[model samples]
Target: MDDKKIVRAWIAYDWANSAFATTIMAAVMPIYFISVAGGTDGSWSFTQTAAAIVVALLSPLLGAIADHSGKKVLFLRVFTVIGAAASVGLAFVGPGDMWLASIIVVIGMVGFGAGNTFYDALLNDITSPEQREKVSSLGYAMGYLGGGLLLAVNLGMILGWESLGLPDKTAASQISFVSVGIWWFVFSLPLFKKIKDPQSTNKSRIGEHLKIGVQRLGETFSRLKKYPELLKFMVAYWFFFDGINTIIVMAASYGTTIGIEETDLITALLITQFIGFPATMLFGKLADRLGSKKMLYSSLVTYLIIVLLGYFMTSSLHFYLLACLVGLVQGGSQATSRAIFSKLIPPGKTAEFNGFLSFTSRFFSFGGPLVFGLVKLISDSSRIALLAVAFFFLMGILLLTFVNLAKGEKEAVQP
Candidate 1:
């Protein structure tokens, strides 16, 4: 098993799935639902979130099944195809069918989110402990790069709606949605071609693996005490990364709620993604040299600063500045954290712990929007929402301070 091929496959998955993140979730879909489909409120947004959460909740069991059955790649392919179909289905949603749009969004969200658990778990099988961060960051970087390029093309087609020969704004949006599906499915083929199934530790038959998935999940939860530091890291990830996800999800919306132009927001987001490419790679190297703990601490500090600066950013120029700041630390922080945990977990239990971590991380996401919504509702301010994210970073930074990285590693693999 060559590491580079695995790395290429992982990065390819990132590019494939990022079409959902950039085009659907972050870019066009929300705007389309609200403006084109006539969704009156945040229901569509909430529904999209619910879909992601439902899939994340199901991740541990599915991951266990994948591990027990050696079916990670197969599951990835199935879910990727499902997500691609749902994404393409968006083009069919029409003028009066907000519900249909919501349905498509949820379907795509579930498939994309669910597929990621298997894709992420494959990391454990492919790379050695020392190689995890670099490889993970490589994937994240390529994701940003590929997503940015495609989004730029889609954004042009969208902003220049009439000239593109689409029927209307709605039609253009619909076509954009389908294009993401095509992009995702087309790119996903490379990973499927290049990567083989992860070797299963369990010799169970498929039926037995299905049965064991539930039991393994129970055992995984029951054994959390055996990996205290891993548990602690998961908790920290839940707090910090939830903040990251929420901010990414909500920031553009927040800008819109307060009168920021859609073009400016989209451009800023593109900037953030492109900047994140080299920035993550740089951070990975820095983490290797300075230590993952120190790197994450630095990244958190940067995040805290960004949130604080966001408080005063009332202009489009300031928003772009903030985007640059986000690019500086966002991928690096996330990549470093993934690498750190990958190093800390027991080999055979990577998916188990990663699933547990994924579940917890996702669980924290539901609240940020609600909190931001409340802050906007009560204070009539988006600044409060921006500031509210800082609390998660504060909590994560505090928890991380309690973690002794080298000591944690010793405990995880003492045998």
Candidate 2:
């Protein structure tokens, strides 16, 4: 396939899978787990941590195998189905089924995250370095629009469950989970049909793939010193992205803790999603003109400001304003980070390197929520817990300054 068509098909996967991100991970399921599943305080956070652990453990090994075996798309397909099936399974979770819900969530989270390790590796295959920023941003922008639209419809269904002949809000929420699975699966068809896997370089026998994968992973770790810029960028990403992911997973529950209504919380997030679509597209253009590193710095500084604002927020209005601020930066920050990492990785080692990036980022991803929970536990204040997140962004900003992008790109092209 041509680059333009391949890029579109690739971008479509973002649109396909983001329903799980918005409704399951970010918007609906977290709240559903708390209110309907009778989950304990911090239970949803713990579930996220559990899922992150599984993804971290699997990512590099899987990436290495995919690199040797030329099976990135196959792995992506398998994980997508696992995620979609798990989403469908969530329909069975009801009141006091927190453990059941947690189990399904962990499976689904692994599927979503592990799938992305390969999906992200495909970026290098679909687009040239010059187009990476624009294409990556467009993918995120499409994700926001797709995920947001589904969330809006699902929210309406949830609030109007009785009018729609559903027994209750719980039934509507259950149906929404199934909808995410169906939506995720149906929309994923384009990419599955259109995008072919990149060729394998090693072409080792199938039986040796596992041993080779392990060896490849060890070699990459041993050679980390050869790619100092990539290492620095990954460390910077590990911290900031952890903070970003924690806020996304925790924001709804935090709003509820602060006395904001569930409806308002969902509505505020919907606003964030729509605003993110346009803002992310704009950020892509800006990054091209102003440089990805500079745009990243700008977004991190804004997140630091947002974290401080979140500390003082006392009303739904404050939550809405803060959500808007998050929308303005979240997608842009992530898209640029992905673009930066794509440039830093060696050409043939894309999947292996992307997997290592995923390993560190998701492994330490536990830190943000763990810290959030601990601070809240110690001080009995969600505000203080929110304040603690600023430390990650601060460290991210400091670490990011040391990344010389031109030098990193030069190093990546070396044999």
Candidate 3:
């Protein structure tokens, strides 16, 4: 395929899978998990922690194996199906089914998180260094647009369930879950068809690939010392991305737990989705001019402020306001981080290194939700749990200051 077509196909995957991100992970399922599924205050948070742990354990090995087997697309397809199927399973969960709901959610999270390792690794294949920030940002922007658009449709179905002949809001939410699965799978077809898996001279059976993956994983860790700038950036990324992920996954549950109306919560997130589309694209363009690192710093600061404000949030208006702030910076922060990491890794090691990136981030990510869950459980106060995330943004900003981007780029090009 042509470069433009390849990039478009690549970007389309973001749109395809983001239905899960916006609806299942961030918006609908969370509220459903809490209100309809009889989830406790900390149950959803614990589920996120559990899912992150599984993905953290799996991503590095899967990524390394895919890199060696030259099967990034195949791995992506497998996990996409896994996640989509799990999403469909969620429709079967009803009241008093928190255990079943959490299990399906964990499965979905693992599929989504693990599959993204390959998706992110493919960034190196589809775009050049000069275009990466823009492409990454565009990918995220499209995710916001695509995820948001479906969320709007799902929102309509949920709000108008009575008119649509649905039995109740729970039934409407159940149908939304099914839609996410179907939407995720159907939209993923473009990339699956267009992006050919690379052929490798070292094609091996699964057992041999597993052995190679373990060796490669060990080698990458030892080799981290040679790429100090990359190491520094990874450390910084681990902190902030954890904060971002925790917020996205936990926000709806938190809102619901705090007694916000379901309609207001969904509507607030819808506002986020639509605003995020244009806002993410703008942040991407601005990153091209001002620098990705600078934009990252700005976004993290916004998150820190949002976390602080969240401690005092007591109304649907506050939830709406916080949702808007989240929409503005969430995609930009993550996209710039991905773009920056792409510049730091050596060639031909994209999948393996990105795997390690996912490993550390997801592994450490459990901490944010862990903290949020523990704090909420211990203090019996959701406000304090929300405030706790500010610590991560602070640490991320401080660590990021030590990363010299030019130095990292210089190290990457070395033999």
Candidate 4:
């Protein structure tokens, strides 16, 4: 495959998948889960934690299987279809159907989370190490643009529902779920058609593949000490990345809880999406000059500041300001972390290692929201809950200080 085509196809998947992140995960769904379904913020957080735990348990095994069989694309397709279908199903849910909504959300979350492992692994196939940081940032930039575009349309749909002949905002919101599913499916076609997979001769029967997958997973776990730097990086990622994920997942809900209007929350999300595009690209360039580690540290510091600001946030204006700050650092931190991890794993083991990375990340991710929910329940203050999340970023920064990036990169280059 041509390098440019491969990179474009890979990045296109981000464009496809991010609609789910923006609409379903970050924007509309949480609000719907709360207002329409009569569910509490804690309930929403627990549901997400439940889904993450399931995906965390399954990611390493599934990743190992795909690596052994060279069927990363196959797994990606399966999960994408599952997630998109579940997203479409969400449109049919009515008021007082929280149970049904939670079930569908879990299925969709599983598909989205598991599919990302294979997508991340594909970084090794699509880009040279020297290009990974830039390419990764490009993917995130495209994600922000694509996701932002669809969200812009969705927001208009909700705000202008009466003019559009819709009954109410509720109807518009429900239809937006269906639009996201269609958008995700339509945009994913290029990735399916354009990207080529690496070849493998290990095409065993399904039962044999399962057996080997389990064995390899066990072996990977046992050999963690052999890659101490990678292990340390995973630990740091668990803390900080969990904090990032928690913010993405909870920001809208937190805004709503603090008496910010839904329109304001959605508009702020739009700002984050559009601003994130250029910020992510700029981080790509900076990563090449300042080093990915330094860029990542800068992002972490910014996030810490965002968290502190969240505690003092009162009006829509504060929310908008914090949202822009989040946009500036969100893609930079995540893309740089991904590029750094890609440099630590062995070439052929990308899927398996990325799976392990997802496992640790998602497992710890469960705690952030859970803790946020617990804090909110105890204090009756979303402000305090938001402030508590800062501890994760602080611990992540501390642990990251232990990683030796030079040694990790050298180990990855070895046979």
List candidate 3 segments past 4 Å from native.
34-38, 94-96, 253-259, 370-385
Give all TM-scores, in the order shown.
Answer: 0.94, 0.95, 0.92, 0.94
Off by over 4 Å in 2: 199-206
The best candidate in terms of lDDT? 2
Top TM-score hit? 2
What tens-digit string does per-residue lDDT give for candidate 4 at 121-199? 9888878889999999999999999999998888899889999999988899999999988888888888888875667
Lowest-sum lDDT 10-residue window in model 1: 197-206
For each predicted model, how many residue pairs clash, with residues at least 3 apart or on different chains? 0, 0, 0, 0
Q: Write down the lDDT of every candidate, Cα atoms only.
A: 0.82, 0.92, 0.90, 0.90
lDDT per residue as tens, model 2, 1-415: 2378778989988898999999998888987998999996578868977998999989999999998888999999999999999999999999999999999999999999999999999999889898899999999999999999999999999989988999999999999999999999998888899898855566577669989999999999988889999989988999899989888867877888999997788889899999999999999999999999999999999999999999999999999999999999999999999999999998778889989989988778778888998999999999999999999999999999999999999999988
Per-residue lDDT for 201-239 in model 3, tens only?
875789999999999999999999999999999998989
lDDT of 2 at 104: 100
Colliding pairs, model 3: none
Q: Tell me the deviation in Å of residue 278 in model 2.
A: 0.7
lDDT of 2 at 51: 91
Per-residue alpha-carbon lDDT of model 1 for 1-415, expressed as tens digits? 4468657877888888888888888888877788877886578766776787788787787887876677788988999999999999998887778888887888888888778887877777777777777788888888888888888888888778888777677777877888899999999987899888746576777788778888989998887787788778878888888778877877877777767898899899999999988998888888878888898999899989988998888889989999999998998888888888877777667666677677777877777777777887888878887798788889999998877777778877866
Residue ranges of candidate 1 with Cα displaced over 4 Å: 198-207
